[model samples]
Target: MSQQQDLNLFVDNSIIPQKVYRDEPLFGVITHTQGTSPSWLINLLIENALYGTCVINHEKNQHRQLRSNVVVISFLNDFDFYEKDLKRNGIEVNDNQQFHFIDLFTDLFQKINTPESIVKIFDQLSKTIQNIPNKKTILIEGIEFLLSSTGITSIQLLNQINKLNKIADALFIITGADKELIDIQHANPSLPEFKTLDFIIRLLHRSNIVLGLRPLETGRAKDITGTLTISKGTIPFDSLVVSEKEYLFFVSRETTKLFFR
Candidate 1:
């Protein structure tokens, strides 16, 4: 990809539509390949935090926005490990209040063994958000992880999200889906065996906005030239609009530019 192509990927006027940042509740599902990391999701979260928005993340150990108001609830690793990881990723952690790491591999297993314990966990999450005075944007990295860990039904997870949405006064709730499973189902329509893929479909149906990320067509080793597709939702620009349609986007480390494919 040339520099012009990279520049063209960014939305015109160097501004995303106001509707993209509106106060109304927005639920988005981002689908990405399994082996490939979803780096754009982190970029989006950091951008939101740069604008002074409070981002509450429930995800694995990854680079976090180095802002005091950005809260991360890490389940994959310990606090020290996350801090080291962030530093390695070129992100500086100036604020001590930025992370709240919960080692699920150790602590969660000890406490949350039964279904009742799972309910308490959800209750605790709800209460934590309730105590925070302002509106929050919750970004849950692995919906599949939650399902596999707790053995909770898809309907139950949806209910938990709904409950959190109500208590947190959440402006947006963003979660991820597995694209590899989706691709498998798409390739072979005759053999539909993955229940996890079915749950992801349900999630996409439930979301107001759905964005998909895929590797570049060239099959490069690095995630240099990927595609972003808006499978649903309409975001209105100043004079132009993107609605009720599928739009293609070119994504890089620098920018995500959208255009009609």
Candidate 2:
């Protein structure tokens, strides 16, 4: 692809109104993809959708607005979610801020906390954005826990999200997904969803969205396009390129754009 075409492919295209998710069932459709899990993509879609309001408030500057609400919830121990990286880097969150990274999900959404307790947190958040009328946007990080560790079924997660959906106009859950694990159904008996992308496609069938970067290994990006690169030092594009030992993407939506090293 020409540089311009590549750039266009990467840029945020005009939202296809028919394509953008408008209701709960569509959100469901957006969750499941063939040979993959829909949870991670669900979060990505939520972030972008919630971001629209932030963009409107920020005078059409999505990046600046997103940066403001970009809470980097990390599953990595050293990262410890928020204290170590996002806050340390000087990202700030206030009532007027468009985006704020929520690094520590355990701290935010522990099931132990009563619904009332959770409601308090949401209630407090609502008071600040008085003009918005309702708190419709919340981007959640750390979905791998819900999938693998939360000790909850995929249906349960969807139900919980359904409740949250009623409270907020839009919600996104961010989690790490390793497709390789899902691709090998016979080899591993642990994950039932691993057998095919049916799980993912089914999940997304309820939601509307676009896929982001493809998983790959570090240094592979350099090999693919020596001239196209990120300024940051090279690392495995593990999500984009599948290694001999990893799983590759089986489904790619033609309407969605992809960006990777």
Query: Which candidate tops TM-score?
Result: 1
lDDT of each: 0.48, 0.34
Model 1 per-residue lDDT tens digits across residues 159-182: 766666675322233344545444
Compute each candidate's TM-score over C-alphas: 0.63, 0.45
Q: Cα RMSD (Å) between model 1 and the true structure?
A: 7.5
The TM-score of predicted model 2 comes to 0.45
Looking at model 2, report the run of 10 residues with the lowest lDDT sum: 225-234
Cα lDDT of model 2 by residue, 1-261, tens digit:
312111211113321111222332112121122223433233333334434322112233445323112223233332333333333223333343444443444464464244455445445544543333423455444444434443344554455555544554434443333465256546442364442233343344554332333334443332221121111112222122211111122223222222332
User: So what's the TM-score on candidate 1?
Assistant: 0.63
Among all candidates shown, the one with the greatest lDDT: 1
